[model samples]
Target: MPCVLTPDPTAQETPARPTSTSTSLRDRSSAMLREHLRPTIQFLLVGGVVFLLDTAMYNLLVFWSPSHGWGTGLMHGTPLTAKVLTIAVASCLTYLGNRLWTFGDRPRPGTTRSIMLFILVNLIAAGLQLSCLGFSRYVLGLDSVLADNISGTLIGQVVSTSFRYVTYGRLVFPKH
Candidate 1:
């Protein structure tokens, strides 16, 4: 028979026992998954804010490009450069905000590397986005500024988000 004997009501109260797999590997992994989710949500929220800013800037640039005499040129320089510049600036702001708040607990490899690596990843993605945007702008005759921004912004972010998540998951957050 199973031992079911001793009530100790008169003795000092004992702590409640952990009835689940709280001390097991599955529980540990589940906890890690839970922790990772918060950062993922933060990345999305933060990235969304940055995406809005990029779209607004793209539209603004297109709107004023003619007046400032910069939009008429080809992809190598002119408006292409402007688009990249604007995205870079916005990314700079994002990095700061994300490092301090969003992925604050993540293990970034110090300021300089973190800044360079993060921006490098973003810029590479930006380049892809801009390339597509430029194509849409000139080749596809997507003359409308809003349409161009929407396509480039959405497409570029989706592509970059894949790589960015890898970086954030492995490098930024580490196994902590």
Candidate 2:
């Protein structure tokens, strides 16, 4: 007896509606999860680094600087100045990390528009943080160290970090 092999005719046919099938749905969901998980984890890791750097630098400047130090006098208090400077540094670090690792899959690499959008997002985050600080200090009249830390670092960061993650993915490092 002789044997012959033939290709299945259906093997070459493409599905007209992939999404309507259960298998397709499962596959699509799994793929979506995998795709999002990578960037989400990387973004979180980069965010931790940026947060630590920004907070530590902000505290250093706030505590170490003299009352009338070079940049301290520009703002009425050192908290605002420290936050501004540290956030600037953190923003740069974040941009580099997200560009190189988190959202590296973006079509274009380091365009001026991307950088500007990143900066704009960071500026908005800074404003949200500053508002938290102001509310804690002025509206609530809670100007103690603990209060300030809670308001600015915890509350403000929670808000701004959420915003940053969403916007960075959607605007700064959009998936083509």
Candidate 3:
């Protein structure tokens, strides 16, 4: 047989790579990382949405509460029930957004299982937050009410939210 006349080797090399034998090798290395990274970025974006929504609602409530008589001076401290209620509303908003958009694209076994895992993972986070709140208020003796709220809600929320993100990404969203 005659030797094949070919185009440029370098051009062929790069373009051929698309359907290439080497693609599997490159893909093999990247498969795990891509699987891991995609959900992470998605979750972070969802978290951003939730944060903005939650913060806006919370601030609005605070601003309006004064008209209803719970102003700064009248409000010596935010009650736990109020805090919990705010979080509960925010959490519902987050869950709805997350379920509809964030992890919605991923293949799930079923809504029940997915929701169970989602709630369980987040409950751990919620517990961590409450525990932190208890610690800061009762154990650490943080006198300034605002300071205690920051230490507890802000710090604890960060930690637990991290846990929620990882667990939901890896476990709740099953591979298709």
Give the best candidate by lDDT.
2
Supply the global lDDT for candidate 2: 0.82
In order of TM-score, best first, we have 2, 1, 3
Q: Tens-digit lDDT track for model 3 on 25-100?
A: 7888799787667666766787777666654554444334545643442323553444455566767776776676
Model 1: clashing residue pairs? none
Compose the digit string of candidate 2's lDDT tens values, residues 1-176.
78999889878876676455887889889999998999999999999998888766766665444655533333336576667887888889999999999988787765898989988999999999989988987898875556766888778888899999999999998877
lDDT per model vs. reference: 0.70, 0.82, 0.64
Residue-wise C-alpha lDDT for candidate 1, range 1-176, written one tens digit per residue: 99898978788986997767755767889988997788788888888888788766765665554446544323323556667877887778777767877778766556676666776777676777777777877788785555665667777667766777777556644545
Best by TM-score: 2
Q: Give the better candidate number (1 or 2) by lDDT.
A: 2
Candidate 1's C-alpha runs over 4 A off are: 1-29, 64-78, 107-109, 172-176
TM-score of each: 0.68, 0.77, 0.65
What TM-score does structure 3 among the candidates reach? 0.65
TM-score of 1: 0.68
How many pairs of residues collide in each model? 0, 0, 0
